[model samples]
Target: MGQQYLFWFAQVHDDFRIPELQSVAEIHGFDLHIPQDLDASRPFCILELDHEEHARLLARRCILIRSVCEFYARGSTYEELHERVRQQRPRWSCYIEDTSFKFIVTAYNHTIPQARQREVVESFSYMDFLGKIDMKSPEIIMTCFEEYPDKHGTTRPKDEGDGEFKEVFFGRLIEEGSARPLVKKFDVKKRLYYGNTSMEAEISLLMANQTLAAPGKLIYDPFIGTGSMAYTTAHFGALVFGSDIDGRQMRGKDKQPGIIRAASQYGVAHCIIDLCTFDVTRNPWRCGELFDAIITDPPYGVRAGAKRLGRKSRQDKEQPPTSPQNIAFRRPDDQPYIPPTKPYELSSLASDLVLLARYMLKPQGRLVFFLPTVTDEYEELDVQSMLCDGMEIVANSLQNFGSWGRRLITIRKATTEHFAPPSFEQLDNVAHIPAHKDFREKYFQGFKKSDVEQISELSDQG
Candidate 1:
């Protein structure tokens, strides 16, 4: 039989755990089995992969997963779990032979005591091993986990809390999850440049995983801020490119210290192809080239309002005194023409982003991006709604923040059909992005009239 492995997911952001698994597996060439009814919110689940090496590869890139192991036993109760562990003693002994090992217990969704932990370890004393115990650095880590669900909506375990066990699992450590190291390496705290909407490193890496990023692949982000997606994509060896309507996000014409600093810090400075000052509504890419992935967190008009290139509807009737600070540099016979920015509707921005992906992505290449929504009013967006002639939905993962959260949606170009841009009406009917159309107004409506000044600062939050 093919080997069975267990992946331990952090209780936080459980929604992303499985989708990240599917993505990492697809990118690495492993046809992993995805359980249809699996509760990804739980601490652990068994993955039926073709080989042990496949499990190792998954652990290397997975951010939501805490660790991966050779699954030994799983059960609904302590009695059943111990019985299964006892049955595996013959094979277990062989695995432990000539190997220094350590035992660990993890009680998920609940707190465990040291005395109780020792009692559990003593229960497994019947097994035999030839090597000495090594706690600091063991070749093998045999683990037992007890999981419990909260008594109610509150995950906070009270001082007198004693939650009932929901499940039990046992496994041998294959590898620890890569999320920790990757997070430390690209943390936004250390980034030289960032926006109020500047992305966190863990989420950026998770998005990259969902995009199925890999070395030598081409990825682009249209709303690149502080190069979150850019550097994270480069970290995975992808050639990254990005554009934004806001020149301020780039800082200056020749200097993008934040972007350059981050890329340099991660040693992926060479992967950044270029950063263009272009509007998504009016895509500037004319080359026949296509990208392997298009990943972004588009402006929701919540923090930073969406904008586009345009001109005033009416010309100024008067010319005022021009100081050196406001003087226009031009030839004597030439008239300087300046372009102003107009409000770009959020619904239109969403439509444009998807259309851009459809036109520029290679067949089988993935388009991953986030869409905002209310927690209680979230209408799950299906890939069917955004389907073009050859596009298919690959994955959808959601994360909530108070009453608001964003969904990470990925769709793939399944065939070689040329992109045929959909009409505004046609695209609007596909998903619930209408909420974004008035996002800024509705978002600010929550505050009092006195808080208008704070809106500027609020828009700057990451």
Candidate 2:
């Protein structure tokens, strides 16, 4: 039987932690049972692994998981917890007698006082010791977790401590999670290039994690804004390639060096295969079924405007230069004409991405992308229809802050043997933009639209 372990998950991005962990676990062929429909808010969870290497692999891939530990004891009360630990005292003495170690306590929904924490640490000092103590760097790290009496993690004095804890756990730490430092390594504030809608490094890596990013895999990003997705995938050793609709975005518009700096900045330049200014709707990729994954954050026309190639407007026309300097600065006629872009609706963007992934992705390959829309708009569009063709939804994780939230949908291409795609009608639903609901109204749901119009009218009159 595999050894048992306790996983202390970080309390953030609650909705995404499970899907991300499960996705990675599936890739490694490690079957982990987390029966409690747990969220990040609940920090304590148990993981049963067949081997210690398997536990380390899980920790290496997870940013949400703070750390994994060697399972020691678990119980409903501190007394039970200590009693269970007592059972292992004979065995633990051998592991700890001559080892340098540190005991850290983490209390969920409650804070363990320093005095109480000291007591907990000292309680374990009964074990025979020969090695010198080293708190800065220990060969062995020990941990104790105190789960509160209720979901809120409240505590009571020893006089009335019967139900003070729902669960208590003690374990030997395996290794600290690799993700916390990665978060700091890829922090947006330190990025050489970023945008109004640039995906945060943490979430960017989450998208990469959902796909199980690995060395030699091909990852494509349809809408590579500041290349957060690209950088993350490349960082994982995947050969990353992507494009932006506007060449200006990649070539540098106003001192923004586009996505190239991200590679150089991150020192993962070799992993970046190619980044171009190509329309996703058009099949620019000649490498059929060559990509192993596709990760992107398609523009939602909210923070950044979503656009596609289309006919030029009335103001777009070539005119004779009025001066010698004007002619000198004029775009060379030999230069290829770059088409103008029109508004690209959110629904249409989803359709093109899925269709592109069908041919672009090898069967069983993954696609992870974001979809942010108003609840009303989302229902009207029927998000299921988005994956009706050529793919199946592996996981759908939502991170909703308020009225508007984004869903990260991970998909795998359905092979011919198991290819049961949605009918043409369902695929057609992707292009169908529901009735022109008040886009502005729903976006600013916090404020009334009528008042916005009233203020606009007043400003115009003034």
Candidate 3:
């Protein structure tokens, strides 16, 4: 008279949840019957059957199912009432049929005492209990008392000494280890151009794990400030290559030796390049050379004074100063060069991204980049437009760290064999744009002209 039950775990993202469940199923070597329109909100379900062990096996694989409860009840205390009920019962009590009654016990109450809870749990027989209970409108109740230390200095409860009563009322359900599967670890540090932290490295590892980059595949990072992105990718078995405009900033005299050292420490192969320049407008990398994936955190509107060229004063501007304004800021060892324009524009930041996408990425390769969304339009709209034609946005997620609005955009190159551009025109008729007033009213709070000017100036330097 044992019973069977079906259990399921609630998951956050439906996209990966099925895969996780399938992985669990494979481990247990069982075929789970999933309803086509199953309700995720209702976490667990039970089925009455002869084989209870098979039900337990299914429960173990469903790690997402947090807790489970079974239905059972003992006989009434009144002997005369029981005898009257027995006289009305059917003759075949010992060999009950499966469809005898459909007792729906939806509610339960805990009634077991703490001291005798364990002993009570060991004595109850699931099979025997199922046989005795009336199937219709059964009361599902269990007695269990849990101990909690008095936080407000309250007195403890006096002993009642009812061990046998406790054993008859409640029992403990044992859980099988079916849920937590082993996850592969990527051991490396990640330093975002925006900032450096252990959390950023962990996030990068999570993103990399989602991609199909295999071991020995080249993972390139063009804007490898301190090699955080490169480090995380390499730790997962991909060969990493990182480059920075100023290699000195990567290691200097004391810090870790950039991506090269990071890869070595993590037991991954890597190469580092210094002062490499590639214009995004035109693909600069040699043809035929490509990477399996590219991940980077482009430099935001922040600059080091020593690393930046300064502007000439207004007083000296009319005369066209004999020496360039940035001459004073250049390193002592470096020779001063005259500025072609009054204030030499820093290298275009957006162009670097375009170059990386066009020249470096392989066909069907994936890219995960973090960009700050401070302005209404990103500076590299042209590059984005170009990418839109050949790439699909897989995920656009936001990560807010302090004042920065970091947007993580994951994109994958269109599979050329069966690729077709999305028909935006067809959807435009139904597309809704939030009113301009709504945006201005919500985001313009406490915003001043000076703040915009300051942000504009920062974007120029980088």
Best by TM-score: 1
Q: Please write out the lDDT profile of model 2 over residues 1-462, one tens digit for every residue.
A: 677788888777877877877877876888766667554456777767788887788788888888999988998867788888888776477765578877798676566767778887777665656676789998888889887744434455643442366788999999778866788888888987777778887899899898878887988887887788888888878898878887666656545355777678899877888878877765355556778998988887566767776533543455332455654566587886555566666665676667767767788888899877554345734556666566888777777755567788898887743332212122343355542233434554443557778877988999
Model 2 error, position 384 (Å): 2.4
Using TM-score, rank the candidates from best to worst: 1, 2, 3
| Residue 247 lDDT, candidate 2, scale 0-100 | 67
Candidate 1 per-residue lDDT over residues 1-462, each given as its tens digit: 687788888767788888888888898877888878887877789878888888888888888778988888988877788889888776577755688988998787676777777888877776766688899998889988887776556646353344257888998998988665888887888876666788888899899888888888999888886688888888888999888887568653346456876688789888998888777666667752379999998877777877777533343235343444454554243754444576766656666667667788887888898877555544544334445566677877778776566778788878787865433332435444444445566565652334655775687883
CA-lDDT, candidates in order: 0.75, 0.73, 0.42
Each prediction's RMSD to truth: 5.8, 5.9, 13.4
Clashes of each: 3, 0, 11
Best by lDDT: 1
> Candidate 1: lDDT over CA atoms?
0.75
* TM-score for each candidate, following the candidate numbering: 0.85, 0.80, 0.45
